[model samples]
Target: MKNNENSDIHLVINIAQQTLILYQHNKKMAQYAVSTAKNGIGSQQDSGCTPLGKHFIAKKIGASEPINTVFIGRVPTGEIYEAKLGMLHPERDWILSRILWLGGVEEGLNKGSNSEGGCDTYQRYIYIHGTPDSEPMGEPLSHGCIRMRNEDIIKLFDQVEAGTSVVIIAH
Candidate 1:
């Protein structure tokens, strides 16, 4: 295998600054603006808040798909996002381009129950995915996922793989 494919890759999502940094072999590769949950951070299920702590890319979805392709339930919906289409579905939480589903590695904090209900990141369907181009970046405005630009998500998707380590921090 090529060295690039075998190198260690890690992601650090900073909620406070609303940015996601990509690190390869302990060196910074790229950084992208992101929008975290509007409700801020938490681990409880149904909180509609982004879970914080150690995580990993459990699944990488929408490879080779066209940019702006809409996804629902992690499945491509055969519709490419456009301004007109966005206007037609104003209530939709658009998951476009690509998706990097996250699974929390920290138990009782983000992986499992925490004296309350379930806190599993995978179960909660937390992801670093693309949003509509109209949506503002570097702002807390998502339901629970980390929202990125369509092109940016595609770029990030190509550089990382499933099981890549991630750490989401408040600051």
Candidate 2:
């Protein structure tokens, strides 16, 4: 492991600041600008908003893929992202590089069936993944996931495991 194996590692994203911090044993290891949801924060199913409270990485995908590699349905699309690619398909929601698929930790809140409200973030297909280089960071501009730069998502994907804790906060 590149990080201290025994140190408790967790990730915290402050929606208000549009930043994410990697913490080890309560000490900040790194900080990066991130883009949350353009629709803002909420837990309703199909809300297209970022969910609040606790979560964990349920799945990690694309460990060896090149940066800017495109993903569809959480599978790499066998194509790398370029400006021309976006121009060709102007409506695709880009999921690139690596993915840390999030699952809700709070019961009946961020996690169950969509009927009552929100069930699981996993069911919602929420992830922290890379976006196009042209997309501005530190802004509320993503559909409903945490969006990072291709380089940053690659770095983060290497540092955390499937069960690592994550907390999303508004401020």
Candidate 3:
């Protein structure tokens, strides 16, 4: 992405508050309640926990799709998420609305490592995406990804572009 592409907007996810703040030109544009990982905060593969520190929107998916559109591996499945679909697959980790695939900015902290303590968040496939309406927000309930409501994620996806800076803070 060009340097100017995301210069005007950025995102900050506060784990403690379970909220994501959108900033444009360094001013708060919007805030949305979110759900983080249920396993808590950590930088480890298979931990099912949210990783901390600075990151960026590595990729943006599901543009032009309707709300509740289902995505698998960032590819639209052509299926819109509804209540019955969720009930049929109760064990599924629904990735709906839009996907803001995240890549870590710091090495050895939240990115880059295939060894004992090197857990790359990008490699972890961590994303900010939408979940079922029946799901609760403002809580730690996801499986490592940051979950948002359908309406909120759609709104956010329209406002931000790829490469936008994203900071996740534990406090």
lDDT of 1 by residue, 104-142 (tens): 877899887878979999999999999998999999999
Indicate which candidate wins on lDDT.
1
**lDDT, candidate 3, 85-149, per-residue tens:** 98888888999989999999788878897467668888999999999999999989999999999
TM-score of structure candidate 2: 0.93
TM-score of each: 0.95, 0.93, 0.94
Positional deviation of 95 in candidate 1, in angstroms? 0.2
**Candidate 3 lDDT:** 0.90
lDDT of 3 at 25: 88
Question: CA lDDT of each candidate?
Answer: 0.91, 0.90, 0.90
Considering summed lDDT, which 10 consecutive residues are worst modelled in model 3?
Answer: 1-10
List the candidate 3 regions with Cα displacement exceeding 4 Å.
Answer: 1-6
Give lDDT tens digits, candidate 2, residues 28-146.
Answer: 99999999999999877788899998888889999999999999998998999999999999999999999999988777777875556656788899999999999999989998899
Residue-pair clashes per candidate, as listed? 0, 2, 0
